[model samples]
Target: MSTEILEQEIALLRQENASLKQQIAASIAELNTTIAKLEQEISEHKQTEVVLKASQAELLAIFNAIQDVILILDFEGRYLKIAPSSAPSLYKPPVELLGKTMHEVLPAAFADYFLDGVHKVLKTRQIEKLEYSLPVGDREIWFEATVAPMSENTVVCVARDISDRQQIEAQLRHQTKDLEQTLQELKRTQAQMLQAEKMSSLGQLVAGVAHEINNPVNFIHGNLSHLEAHIQDLLHIIHLYPQQSLETEISDLDAEIDLEYIKDDLPKILSSMKVGTQRIRQIVLSLRNFSRMDEADFKAVDIHEGIDSTLMILQYRLKEKSERPAIQVVKNYGTLPLIECYPGQLNQVFMNILANAIDVLEQRIESKDAPLPTITISTSLVAEGWVKIAIADNGGGMPEDVQKKVFNPFFTTKPVGKGTGMGMSISYQIVTEKHRGKLECCSIVGEGTEFVIEIPIQQ
Candidate 1:
């Protein structure tokens, strides 16, 4: 019985050992599969770690390359993280800034501004910008900050130095101011030149007027003496009519006085005196019109009337002289409506242009092969609600380069004392700025020169 029991127990123990081995082998296989899966997960985790490190390096490199100071701030304007930077706009070092609030490092005003900006970024969830100047030791450095929301209560601030740009804008403003002053001074100088030119023209006008008046006065004086003699002879005849031999005395007196001659000459003297008075009246009218002091402001006026007045004022220069023939003026006027303009200024423009034309024509008179000195003025309604007035001269034409700058300030082709060079420039300003018109010049080398003025008929 003992041997049988021991053998059965041994056999059962063997079978149990075999089943335990099978279970153990299955557990070992499961453990090996789990170990392989764990190893694979570990390898994947290591690769992710490398990729995360690379991303951090790239971000750090990007931050380092930028000149802006990158800072992380809380909603309360506390400096949480400050990127490593060498920017001079930073008021303090990164060590002193981290973990400290802006109120602790900056002035109350700057701290308030920063806190407000951060709150605004958080509220709007959008980027906000602020510009400030910091006193980094002695000098002030300007910075432009861009604050963007990073989280619910955190903001990222990127501040860039803008001192150089601010300085450049300030310099530009100063230069602009200087240029304005210079322009005002130039305008003042031009005004003085214009006044001087006006005085010179007035002098010439006075001389011409005096000469014209003197001739008429001398003729009137001589004619008055002849009229007085004739009247005395007639009076003598009338007084002798009371005498007894009145018929014979009247007949003798009539023969001695040459009554028919007196009758013929009296009307002529009266007619000539009337003509002189009319001429003087015309001259006065022309002067009054040319000066146009009453018309200082804008008014509707006849263009031809102004042109004619200006021509009369400058008539002395156009007369035939000993050295040259008279410069002929040809007017090609078309049907034009009344133009609204400053009459006085327009006359001044006409005077300047005509004077210059006459002078040029006079100079060219010496050339044997030169064309007849002619100043042709043409007026017309060139377009709807606009008028054109062209003044041209068949004289020595100007070059293209000279014509380009003809309207520039202080540029003149005449001798130093002869011209102030501001005439055309001022005229251009008057036509363009005051009247809102255009003044242009066109010329050919050997042909002629023309100045065309186009102005709106209405204002």
Candidate 2:
């Protein structure tokens, strides 16, 4: 029984050994599988890390190379990173802006808006663009700023200074205004030429018509003397038998009973007809003289006559009591030689200058309480074959600054609808360029202004 129990114990020990060996083998197999799985996971993780590193390097390079002023800000509007290109030349390096609130670093005035924009971008993740001028150091600089959300709690702002472009834009605007002014001046000049041409044509037509009319008018006047003599003889014969022969002659004529009255009124009718015909002749002569259609060259002309004719043309302005400043004209005539010029053009110059003088004189009278404003026109032959015409007026004179700009195109001191500044410019071009004359102004602040026109007669 002892031997049998020993054998059974040995068998039990053998089974236990086999079971322990199987458990060891199973454990080893499980360990090997776990090691292979871990190695595969490690390889995948290393590949992902390499890809992430390369993306990070590329992103850093891109951020640094941007030309715009790029900055990273926290949700609270604090600066986290500033691109190197964003720093101004005079400013410290971009690192100095890091880890500081925008409000704490920038000035209070500029900080508020910048911080507001940054926070907005952070909250909405939406891009915002703004343009404003910022004071950098002492001077102001214009910037076009753009803010964009980079992450859930961060913002990236980019700014570009566009002050130079703005200055160029302003310059362009000024040049455009100047060009427009030049174009308007050109138009006015063209119109004035057309008007002068039309007037010349009309003057010639009127002069020819007046001359033809004068011949017929003279014919009627020439017949008047013969008609008067015939009528006088007839009347004297009728008077030979006035009261008694009047009834007898009426019976002899069978129907004419008013021979006495006919004899009485016949002389008056002939005399009136002669006077009327003579008056018609005189009007035709005056029209011929005024138009001067036959002559347009450098001819001998009485300067005072030209002055009087122009004054006559503007007489309506003088006579109308309702016109402003009720102007008073004082003429100071002098003996002057005939100026060698186109009488019509010279007449135009005289008319334009005189009109301007009257206008300015009226304006002065309306503006201030000056006693009886006067425009004194004086003409004299100066030395060196020249003629000096001076038109002086006791009116409001132009200021120095305004005087400087008077010759400029489209510069008018008169309000809109009252005057176009083109009058004097056109007149200037006419006298100085067309006629080769000199026009100069002499003025005092409160006294008045005088315009002196000097032109060589013999040239």
Candidate 3:
């Protein structure tokens, strides 16, 4: 029995030992799992720390790279912080401007503008914008500022330099103005060319007419003297014969023919014919002079001759028309040397101005019971080898606004189709661009208008 009990105790102890061994193994395995999880958690924590550090570095780099001057200000316009990149744009160094109030660092006007924007943004909780200019060093600097509320009592301000943009805008505006002026000049030139062509055709026609009339008029005028002498001789011969000696047939014929009346009227008729021929000759000469078709090139021409020719061309207009009385032209002639110029073009200028003056006078007469219209033309030699011709009219004058644009092409106060509006503009071009001269208009409303033309004596 003792031997059997020993065997069972031994078996039980072995069983207990086996169970404890199993429990120790399980505890060891659990401890190993816990250790591995803790190691994994440590590695993940380190990686997260590295990623956070890199993100912080990248954010700082972005802040430093910004070009705009970023600032934080309190409600009272005191600077709380300044961007690290603001050193170059600030009026002073960052060290000096960092904590200073805007009023302390900037001009009163500029500071007030910024403060106003800040107040507006803080009050409304909305972004506010401002544009201003300030003088820095030797140049003017322009800035556009944006202010937004960052908190209840703080605002973020961003300012950018816009001086270059302003300069570019100004340059563009200047170029646009120049382009407009160029376009207007081109149009004026085209109009002038067209007018010149028309005048050339008219001048050719006048020259041809004058040439054709000259020869026949000369022949008729030359024969009138001979014809008158021949008739006088025949009448003398007939008078020498006695009336009683004359045959009855001759006396009867004389009674039928009325010889006495013929003798009296024949002399008067011849005299009248001579006068008419002289007038025709003068008119032909005036027409030829006015046409100036033969004098196309620049030549030394008598200025008075040009003036007379222009007057003759416009004589019909100067005459008393049914609508108005005759326009009186008072010539204050001056002693002028022969000027070297294009005679035809110069005559055209004279015609335009004189025609305009005549039109003004005629319009005045139709409007009211005005005085007898008068045009006064004065010529004088000025300094610098220049000759001045002043044409003045005693008619209602243009207003200041009209006077200002009187020489602009296509600008007219006359009724359409009545005035081409290119007359004065062409005259201006002729005097200034073609001849290198000056033309000016002086007038007072209700008083009179005067056009002063100055040109050099020699080309």
Candidate 4:
């Protein structure tokens, strides 16, 4: 019995030993699982840290690469932080401005401007933008700033320098102004050229017409004296013949035809024809003198003869028209020596002035019931071998403003299409530039106007 009991005890001990071994294995397995999980968690944590570090580096690089100045300010305008990019733009080091108020670090005007933007952004919770210029050293620096609320009491400011842009804009403005002035000058030159061409063509036409008419008028005038004498001699021979010398039939025919009336009227008719031919001849001569096509170069000319020719050419206009009364011309001539000048151009100047005077006088007649229009012309020899010609009108004169621009090309007081606006301008050029003379106008609004022309006696 003792042996059997001992065997059972041994069996129980073996079973217990097996159970202990199993439990040991299970505990080892569980410890291995827990260790693996902890290792995995540690590995993940390390990877996350690396990613965070890289993100931080990238953010720093972006911040440093920014060109604009970045600043953080509190509600009271105190600088909270400044980006590294602002180092070049700041008045001092970023470290020095980090905790200081804008008023302490910047000028008063700049501080106030920045503070106002900050306050506005904080109150409105909206972005604020402004442009300002500051004189830095010897140069002016322009900046455009944008402020936005970063928090309830903090604002972010981004300012960019705009000096180069401002300079470019100013340069563009100056170029535009220069271009405009050049364009205006080109237009003026074009107008002057066109006027010159027109005058040249007109001169040629006048010269041709005068040449064609002169021959016919001279021939007719030369023949009229001989024709008149022949008619008188024939009439005297008839009167000397006796009535009884004729046959009876001839005597009856002469009595029937009123021979006495024909004898008296034929001589008078011939004399009238002679006078008309003389008048026509004078007019043709005046036309030739006025044209002066043969005398283009500078030559000694009678100024009074030129004036008379111009007057003769314009005589028809001076006569009484149905719309207005006749224009009265009072010529105050002075004894003067001959002058050397361009006769054709000088005549053109005279024509322009006289025609303009006539136009003004006619306008006055149409607008007002005033006295008869009168043009007074006076000539005198001034000192220094100069001649002065004063042509005045008793009509409404121009204002000061009009007188100032009267010689400018394409400037006129007449209605469009009625005046080419080039007459006075060309006249001015002829008197001043072509002849090396002076032309001036003196006018009073209601007292009429006078134009004074001064020219040297010799070229």
Candidate 5:
């Protein structure tokens, strides 16, 4: 019985040991599976870490590449993170600016402005664009900032220095002003050349006409004296023959021919011819003075002579026409010194002013009983050794606005074909710019217009 019991116990023991070995083997397989799975998860985690590091490095690279003064701040204007920047206009360096409230690092006024901007961004939930200035050390620097919401409580500001752009704009403005001034000078010069050419041509024409008329006048004048002397001799001979000595045929011929009447009329005709010739000679001389063919250069000349000569040249226009009465000229001449000036140019100024005055008078549309069309010219040496010549017309005056722009180029109040707008403009330049003078216009509606020209008497 004891031997059977021992065998059964050994069998039971063997069964238990085999069962335990199988369980242990299962446990080892499960442990190996768990270890393999854990190893795969570790590898995946390492790959994710690598990807995160690459993303972080890329973000940092982009932030630095933008090269703006970037700031991350909370709504209270406290700096949260400051990006490294290469800009030179920062109020404070990145190292010092980080972790600082705006009030602690900036002026109180500017700090308040910045905090308001941040609040505005949060309330509107939109990007804010603004400009500001900061004093670095000695100079103020301009900055442009772009602020955008970064989180519920924070904002990001990207600022750039715009001082260089502003400087370029200012330079452009200065250059434009210089160009405009140069253009005006060029225009004035061109006007002077054109007017000078016209005056020269006119002078040549007048000189030619004067020379032509003078030749015939001289021939006729010289012959009149000789012809008169010969006729007187003949008349003396006839009178000496006596009526008593006349034959019947000669007396009858005298009765038929009226010889006595012819004798009486002949002397009076000769006397009138002499007077006419003298008037012709005087007109020719005036013409010569006016053309000034030999007086083109600057020299001391009688200002009154210039004015009178110009008036003489314009006499035809001043004469009475069938349509209107003659325009009267009243001259109040004051004693003046011989003014040193370009005589021809001064004459041209006179011509322009007088011509304009005549035009105004001729174009009078007033009632027939209106004041007689008169131009009053006054000359005087005002207090500074200056010659003042005022030409005024009692014709229709210009409006205040027209008077203001009267001296501007291409401004005219006449019909296109009758007037070249450059006349008054050139006259102004001749007086003011060339001769260092002042030309002023005074006028009142329905009253009269006067142009006052003041110039130094000496060069």
Candidate 6:
């Protein structure tokens, strides 16, 4: 019994051992194939990692080459990275900036706003723009900054400065203003020259006529007393004729006297001679006033004298009565310090303004039934260094549009042959440029017009 059991056990063991050997060989083959596949996959993964690292290095190089200032902040708003393109001189390498809070590395004044902008982008995950200024050293730099969000609580900020453009714009504005002022001054000078030319021509004409007329006027004036004396002697001789003619020889006195008409006409002839003499005297006086030879020199002069002389020259015009206007002249002179100026030029200014005032008054009165026309002149010492002269007229005032162009050269509101349109403009130049003073005008439509001139007092 033992032998049979042993033989069966041995055969079973042999069969099981052979089967186990085949299973072990198959398992070993499967394990080897699986390990080879895993090793290949590991090698491929390592190659892909190397390629990715190479691409990242290339990207970093490109980023560093740019000139713009770039900063990278960590999750907590600390400076984690910086590129050379941004803040080349202001910051060092990214390693230096690493692990430092933005505020700590940079001053609080500069970093506060920068960090705030960066955090805002990080929190909102959106691009934020800011424009501000900072003092780089001594000069101010204006910057425009763009903050953008990166991966997971990281932000990138870029900044650029644009101060030169602003400065150029400011200079352009100043040049424009200066050009406009220069143009205005040129116009004023031209107007003044034109006025001076006209006045000089008129003065020459008046002087020539005055000189020519003076001879006849003097001859008539010289003989007037003799004519009166001759009339008295004739009257006396006639009175004695009644007593002496009947007895003594009547030597043709009646024939010499033209007794029929002379008795009545002689008195009228004498009266006419007196009236003519007076008229000639008035004309001579007018000529003198027109010339204004007394105050023609440049010196410290009372403006009132110019005004008075101008008024006297224009007395005939003032006396003229029109159905429309009864022009009245008024002088409201105040104690004024004398001003250094050319008296003849100032007198021309007064004459031009006064004449214009009269014309405007006439127009106003003709247009409607308004108040009586009045031209008023006033003067006063405005301050220690200033003297104010005002000429106001109750005349047809200028409109806004017309007033704007009133000072423009060749602008005229009067009819042709009546005005040259350079009067007020010349006055302005004389008072402002030549005299170193200011001249301004105020007017309201249908109300009145007033011109004010301010000049410095003479030393």
Q: What residue pairs clash in candidate 5, if any at all?
A: none
TM-scores of the models, in the order given: 0.79, 0.42, 0.52, 0.52, 0.53, 0.47
Q: 123 in model 6: Cα distance from truth in Å?
A: 56
Give the runs in model 3 whose Cα sits over 4 Å from its true position.
1-193, 196-246, 366-369
Measured with C-alpha atoms, the lDDT of residue 125 in candidate 1 is 97
Tens digits of per-residue lDDT, candidate 4, 86-157, equal 445555678777888989978899889879888888988999998987665567788888999999999988
The better-scoring model by TM-score among 2 and 4 is: 4
Please report the candidate that would top lDDT against the real structure. Answer: 1
lDDT (C-alpha, whole model) for all candidates: 0.88, 0.70, 0.81, 0.81, 0.81, 0.73
Worst 10 residues of 1 by lDDT: 363-372
Off by over 4 Å in 1: 1-45, 85-87, 200-211, 221-267, 367-371
Which digits, one per residue and each the tens of the lDDT, describe model 3 over residues 1-459? Answer: 699999999999999999999999999999999999989998998899999999988877877787677889998898888876543566666677767898998899889978888888999999988888877677788888888899999999888888899999999999999999999999788768656545643564365445545555776677677667657756755875775656775676567666786678667767766776776777778777866879877888888898887887677668787888899999998999998888887887887788778878988845565778899999999987889999999889999999999999777788865666777887888889888899999988887899999999998
Q: Give per-residue CA lDDT, model 5, range 338-382, as digits (tens).
A: 998777777777877888898888888858679988999999999
Pick by TM-score: 1 or 5, better one: 1
The CA lDDT at 324 in model 4 is: 88
Clashing pairs in 2: none
Instruction: Give me the displacement of residue 202 in model 6, in angstroms.
Output: 1.7
Give candidate 2 regions above 4 Å deviation.
Answer: 1-296, 323-326, 364-369, 415-420
Clashing pairs in 4: none
Each model's Cα RMSD: 4.5, 22.2, 21.7, 23.1, 20.3, 16.1
lDDT by residue for model 6 over 381-401, one digit each (tens)? 886789888999987798889
- TM-score, cand. 3 vs. native: 0.52
- Superposed by TM-score, candidate 1 places the C-alpha of residue 61 at a distance from the truth, in angstroms, of 3.2
lDDT (C-alpha) at residue 73 in model 6: 76
* Candidate 2 C-alpha lDDT tens digits along 265-382: 6666567667666655655554444456677666777767766666655554554366464567788787777766666656666665676677776666454456576778888878
Candidate 6 ranges with C-alpha deviation above 4 Å: 1-297, 322-326, 365-368
Top candidate, metric TM-score: 1
Supply the global lDDT for candidate 3: 0.81
